[model samples]
Target chain A: MGKHVITMLPGEGTGPEICEAVRRIIDHTGVEIVWEYEEIGLDCLDKYGTLLPEKTIKSIAKNKLAIKGPTTTPIGTGHKSANVTLRKMFDLYANVRPAKLIPVLKRPWDKIDILTFRENTEDSYAAIEHMVSDEVAQCLKVITWPGSYRIADFAFKWAKANGRKKIQCVHKANIMKMTDGLFLEAFREAAKKYPEIEYGDIIVDNCSMQLVRNPGQFDCLVLPNLYGDILSDLCAGLVGGLGFAPGANIGDNCAIFEAVHGSAPKYAGMKKVNPSAVLLSGVMMLRWIGENAAADKIENGMNKVLAEGKTLTYDAGGTASTDEYADAIIKAMN
Target chain B: MLTKATTGRAKRPAKPITLVGVDVYIITENGIPAFDDYGAFKIEFVSNRGTKVWPGYVSEDLMLVNWYRCRFMATKAVTDADVDSFLTQLSKKWKWSAAQKLWNYGDEAGFSKAY
Candidate 1:
């Protein structure tokens, strides 16, 4: 059988170095995979005059499955989101992030396993926004019946497939009645299709408070665009910081698993950073490509590394360099 | 204790808050002058925008401006009688049917820097 190939779009700042480490670690593990590299992030923006460059988009379009490093997003400013652009472009409407408790990590919660299946493409993140007339700026929150229903369906399918008992739909329908009201209604319609899974809705703010108070009650929480972004990151903090968080942008046929964080410019080229986010994302990549053996191997190897607490990164509370960490994992795998 | 500006010195903002072409003014909450133009003061109040500080504007249209524009309206020094007359004009023009005397939708689209 032909080897499964995946493109790695290393973006600006520390994006390239981390990608290089990911390359080295995957190669050394003898993980059956092929690499296709592309230049993205700052360099791409400078050359192509936009963050979402044609080459990167073209690469993603061809490959159908890729794992990417971080790109910077200037919040609430000029232009829209980079991730939002990709999700909308490819119709990658379901963002799936599964956070499980890594052993020996000083986390607050127990049974800390949750999958956030966020509505990926629509709502405030669409960049369909304007600062119309200096005093009053506006962002049009567009919610369609089809978009909400499909994302809800994806969440329910994921829950049922994975044996998840509860599926929570988070929204701000009480305050934002019209837009979020539509999303809640669509969630209900999709729930009818998957009656076996238990379901309920929570207000967005209360949801945040609940995650902080008790994250165990959630199995898989799904939400619209902006709410999902904030909730996912908040949930990421619950398990570990965002370094432990990994996400996948999924459409019907296309899926891009990536390290969904900013380009940490200061840590560029140091080889002292943690690559687990991208590595786990690579694990997701392996799963997507039907290389489940390699995927399990990589995950088991990672869990083995985390269990001993040997060769941990600074963020993970140790002095081990990025190479040191990956080498430790590979050693455990061996 | 009242934190007054330095004696004999007018305090200013670090950055000048310029209201571009907006005919709005704020009168200090000190002893406001009488607004009843007919009952009246000897001289008319004036602003940097050259709009008359008329204590007599009863435009139902003007009262419907947004917080951004409404907060910046030109203020004439006004007294109790001026307030009463202004309130009466506002009630009549805006057609204040309710007891509290306010409009539900205060003409958001019609609000602008002009007037």
Candidate 2:
């Protein structure tokens, strides 16, 4: 097969370690992938004066496919999130996060498979905020026709393709009528076109309760930026947690696969944290590049390691270093 | 003044003039200023992002930012000297970032509706 080039963003902290584990695992698949490394986040601030540099963005723009480790953004400053910046820069409006049970792992709920399509660009996450007065502040919640409809369209199309039976649009339309109402309107319009899929609307608060109470009732959920950012994590809890959560921010031309979890800078250089999230993200990148066989091998191998319960990280209830766990998965590959 | 059009004809028009207004955006976090020093101009209204919030009715739900746009309408015919004096007075109390003059070009309003 021809060699594929992917932009690899090794973010700060344990980002590099997990990225290495993923690189080794991908290499074992024998699929030639050139990881064009790029630097970003807090570490690059002194050198580039910005968390996201032009060169790094150029690499992602050219390669069109990137897998990233979590990058940290300084808190309570004017600096925009590097993660949010990349998504908006690429117009990666559809943030697809799939939460499914890892057959071997023990959790409160079983057989939980939910796909969350979050509208990545608009909404209150746009960071348009100002202190009206010393006591009053405002952050504009923006929802547009094209932005809402496109994400809804993406979710519906993906649901139809993946044989998802039910799709729910979650929002607080009762309160923020115009903004959230437009989101629900877009979902309804998209749902109309896909008559085969059973689509409905739910208030975000109620949706959260239902998700925890009976997650199996839903198959797919499409939501605005803030709600999706929150509920996707809740759904992840239903299966395992951020450790098992694999996220993809996809636009028309470019896509970035990344773990939903933070960099966990405290765990840096320890080889202690679970590599499941990033490695599974790599599997997503593999499948996106049409390397289905390699993707299948990685997923199956990971499942086997989980089922065997011999080589697993501390989070997964076993004693294995990040590399050791990855090695086991690679060895288990058929 | 006459200018030649593409058809090689001199474009002519009737002299057009009307009363105009100006909006001075001041950063209010520093301080609010006295509105009495404007020469031949009166403060019509002040708004935050097009919502009326001063001199009359202010919404309780309206969140205030540090920036306020003060609309000044000319009481009489305005001159550059009048504008200079107003700005000079405003500069002493508040930091004004931008001032946009609302023009009446013939019969059309040259600025956006602040609704």
Candidate 3:
């Protein structure tokens, strides 16, 4: 079979390093992938004055799938979120992240596997901000019936397809009744349609507490956009932090798997940071295109390499550099 | 914030809880026709054990007797009782209310799924 072409938006900072390592690995494996490189992130910020440029979006639309590296989310003010903007513009209604227990990292739980189907676009992260007055600040938390219905339906469908037993509708509806209430109501309706799968709701606050207390109890988490962002990060810490957790922002027509970690500018050009997250994201990319075998090769090899614990990096408590770690896995695979 | 100085002030005192916005008929322990007040039942929780257990709001206290596990109390509370009766009553109020508030708040907290 001829190679399938994929685009690479290797953003600024360690983005380049990780993307470089991933690209090298793809080439080394003799996997049929043609990657097109493009400039984005801080470099885009300095030159184009936009965090996400029109050209980047256009290219991504053409490819329909991409492997992205960490980009600098312009700090301070007046900067658009490169990730959120793409999700909204493309209507990537679901953000799926599966945090598996990579045995290399020691955690309190035996099995910490969970799949989160977060509703993209339309939540606090909508980036719609307005000040009621000088003394007051307000942000819209919009949740339309259709938006909730689609996301909720999408989640249940995903859970049923994946053989997941239950779908947890995480919400703070008790507090943000009107907004989250609509989400919960949608979940109720969706649950009735999919009687095969179980449905449950948890107050957002207690859900967080319970996550730490017993991470295994939860299965599939479906929530509005904003809660997913905060909760997913915290869950990252539990399953080996950002260094290991991989994320994918998926829409109807396109999917972008990227390192959600920020560009550690200070660590730029050092080649010292862990590239596992981005690489694992590449694993996600592979599976996205039905390359389940390649995806398994990378994941199984990674799991074995980490568990061996010899060729380790700082994040996993050893001193191997990004290349060293990737090299170890590549060698181990051979 | 409550301080230790106020410790033991109410010591199981039967302070009446107001059933501010509810009223309903309840069949009493004697099988007599009686109205059980959900609000008053919840307010009297501290002293009278009038727990307003709605659906999914089960709990355990004294550790042995789980506080919120009353399926019979799954019905919404209405006016009547100690504010008049036993702590046990059937209710179908909001799934959360005070007892299950913990779980609802937890959901608001964030995406907890590990996978």
Candidate 4:
């Protein structure tokens, strides 16, 4: 059995708690993974004077695989998101967020499965704001041909491989004619190559309305950076919430799987927050590494635990602690 | 040796800092058009990535940067809302990436390198 070395980033707040829970559950899979732990986010900021340490980045760069917990991005100012920094550092242009309905959870919509492919590198996220004067400011929204094409290509390839039938390109090209227009054009170009898959375009506003109205109609969605950031959260609402959302940032050389939810600072060290998001992210990591059997087993274990409604954390409407929840899933796996 | 008289111009309150024009960078496939009247405003000149490429330009082999900056000058001083309206109208036909407002500082231009 070959041991797979993966960089583990226990971020901030409840990040460590959930990551520990996920680590224990994954260990039971007998997958022989060597977890290289790295400290990041606020803790790293305190120790190293930077949120994202150079050493941590080098570890992930060397290992090529990382599973991370939620990190805090201070409101108003302090520092930019460490996640965004990492994404830009590795050129992780494709942000894949999968939102699937848990059968046990009672939600407004049912059978909602959506895979959001967000172009993560550019757009307003480039952080190029300039104060033109005392009364005005501007931020450059960069949308390159290469950036657009690669993300669209990744979406189509992933959709085809995952047995998805349709790919929807969501944008506000009607208003942001150039930046978003380039994105739509690239999507159309990529669609032509994947002739087997049905392709369509929708304005970002209408896409939001349609998502909430009939999420099932969308099989797979590919969008620019800003729209993807917004719609992925909206799609997460369709299934359950961010607590169950699993995200993966993938580039050519490295991939990092993470929980879409933020670090619940108030619940830090309480052992009460739900670990479903990070746990499912670990499942995604398993699949990414070709451990289909282990992935399926862990996924099935999660489904069983949720369906039983016996052992669950506070967010899931149960009294069990994070470790207890992981214990239940590990026990159920056997 | 042209020395202009600064009699009444020196007493004026620096023209109150008015918006004279705006440079709208539109992403076009075929580069900037040679003659775009814009109806209300004048299309002074067009440039590809800061190098003037249209309206009696220098080099014959001009490289298109996808982003073409078209300087549109108004007949009179315009407000911020007027600039917004102008951009809104232009967006219907051309895909614009960015717009920078050009100001007239008394006699000289506020933004450097007019063309």
Candidate 5:
């Protein structure tokens, strides 16, 4: 097989550190890949006067496959989110985050496995906010049938493709009936096409409650943008925090696998932060590119290292440095 | 314990507000506001395309527009809770695009002349 050319976005702060660790681990997998490095987020903003540089966009556009680290999105209005900008640019409409309990990690829940499919575009993320008056500020919640249908279809097809048994459509249709009602309607229409998969609908609030109570019952969840954003983080907290979460933004042509955690600028140069999220994201990237064997190998190795409760970073309750932790996983692979 | 009597600012009695009416626009399938009567409140009038299209509306092809504005008046003085109940009931039958509360300031009309 020919070498796969993939775009590597080493983002700002601790992004570079984790990306380096993930790159080393991916290299150890012996997969033939040509890495095209690109800059994004805060560092890119400093250099190119744009958070998402044109060169980075072109690189991902040309390659169609990317593995990225966490990029900072300045709070309280400095610049728009680089992540959102990239998603819109690529039309990466499906945001997939899988939360599965690791055997070694001690948590309140066990045997928990859930996949969250979030609509990547449209909804409140459209950033449409204006003041009707000083007292009344309105933000339009836009949900089109086409947008809802495509995301619902993507969730169903993804479930069917991955051999998932059920899909639950989460929405607030009872309240914002027009916007969320249209979403639920689209989900129902899409569910009819896939008769094999068990389809159900739950209000967003109820879905959140149930997810915490008995998450084992849920197989796959499809939600509109806002609910997905909030629920995905909640789900992340179920198994483990964002440190162990890996995310993928997938469209028809382009896919960007990334760590769901923030850049953690405080731990940027210390090499103390955990790289599990980014490394697992790399594992996801490997699977996307048809290197399933390498993906499985790395996943198993990481699991073994975690299971042993040795050679872990400070966050994981061990004294090992980030590089030391990466080495341990690589050693397990051997 | 020191009470509010020691404070310099005097507390005024809370003003009572009541629901007079509501101007609701229900968005339909074709993105046009639907001209439908909400049973709980009296349907004062319905307008489309900046012209009255219901209850003494002129029959014209131009009046067949998607956007609709309906004025619903309460039978008596209703509290904010009553308005909430009205909205909950209205949402069941129609996809409300926009809603504005019609408050009566004694002799003042909260509604616009366009209605």
Candidate 6:
């Protein structure tokens, strides 16, 4: 097969180094790939004058596939998040994150596999806020039928394809009946199509408690933006941390694979942060592009490396640098 | 706990304020690009969730929903009868979700630009 040309956005802080490590690891897998580098986030603001350069947007629009390292969104008032902008621009409605138990992280649960499908574009993330009065502030919680149905359908379809059984819609419909109610209603409507898949709904708070109590009970949980944002991390905590979780933003036309964690600025030039998240994200991207054999190889290799615990990054309680850890996985692959 | 003796209020300036335009929000899957003038009111442009998306080379990459806000400005001083007539004609073809009147306090606009 000819080389797959994919747009690579090496984001701010520790993004570039970890992306480089992931690239090296993927290269070792013998999957032919041509990387097209793109810029996004604050680091590129000086040169591009915009967080998301137009060229980068054009590249993603053309390629239809991208792998991004963690990008930093500054706290408080600033530009709108480039990540949010990309998702909205491309209509990447489904944020799929798989947080499964990695055997190495000896948590209490022997088997905890949870797939989170987050509605990427709607809810409070819409950035629709205005001061209704001098004291009272209002943020419009926009939820539409089309947006809800598409994400719910995506979740159900994804679960069915991936051999998952149960799918749950998590929401806070008891309180905000109209907004969250619309979400749950859409999930129910979508659920009717896939009768083979057992579907149900749970309130967000109870779902959180259920997750921490016994995560093994759930297979896949589809949630609105706010709940999913909170629960996806909780799901990550079950496995190990953000380092073990890999995420992807998928739409009808485009898909962007990325690490769910943020870029740790303190570890930028240190070569000390873990590359597992981005590497695993690369594995997901490989599977997405039909390079399943290479994906399996890298995944198995990483699993072996994690199992051995001989060479691991500091986050995993070892002294190995990022390059050394990646090299270990690369060596294990062969 | 400390509390203010009285709540502050904003008072209108002594300068004259007049109605200049109206933003009519319509719910539609595909946005309406142009509409004819109703009496003295002329359709300026249409925006979706505050981003301008019509009357020129607008990128198809914008994520569109059902909400579209259309701005219509008056060539002369618009009265309540003018708004009623325009909406009456507008209702014949399209259904409007909401409408907000634009005002000019002296030289400054009461509302922000669509862009």
Candidate 1 docking class: incorrect
Task: Give the DockQ-based CAPRI class for model 5.
Answer: incorrect
Residue A86 of model 3, lDDT score: 64
Q: Which candidate is the best by DockQ?
A: 6
Model 1: residues with Cα > 4 Å off, grouped in runs: A28-31, A75-80, B1-115
Worst 10 residues of 5 chain B by lDDT: B56-65
Per-residue lDDT over A55-142 for candidate 6, one digit per residue giving the tens place of the 0 to 100 score: 9988998898999999888676567678887887776889999998886777999788899999887787765544333334455577
Ranking by DockQ: 6, 4, 5, 2, 1, 3
Prediction 4 TM-score vs. true = 0.76
DockQ of 6: 0.16
- After the best TM-score superposition of candidate 2, give how far the Cα of residue A123 lies from its true spot, in angstroms: 0.4
**Predicted complex 4: CAPRI docking category:** incorrect
Model 6 regions more than 4 Å off: B1-24, B29-32, B35-64, B69-94, B99-115
Output the worst ten-in-a-row residue range by lDDT, candidate 3 chain A: A128-137
lDDT of each: 0.67, 0.81, 0.68, 0.82, 0.80, 0.84
Please estimate how well model 4 matches the true structure, expressed as its whole-model Cα lDDT: 0.82
Shift of residue A268 alpha carbon in model 5, Å: 0.7
List A-chain TM-scores for all predictions.
Answer: 0.94, 0.97, 0.95, 0.98, 0.98, 0.98
The model with the greatest lDDT is 6
The local lDDT score (0 to 100) that residue A78 gets in candidate 1 is: 50
Please, what are the lDDT tens digits per residue for candidate 3 over residues B1-115?
6778867545432233322221222322321122345443332221001222232122221111112222112134443443234334434322212221101121121111000
Which pairs clash (backbone N, Cα, C closer than 3 Å) in model 4? Answer: none
Report the lDDT tens digits of candidate 2 across residue range A134-176. Answer: 2334565767777789899999999898789999999999999
TM-score-superior candidate, 1 or 4: 4
DockQ of each: 0.02, 0.02, 0.01, 0.03, 0.03, 0.16
- Residue-level lDDT of model 4, residues A100-184, one tens digit each, is 8987679877678889999987777765443354344466677777788889999999988889999999999999899899999
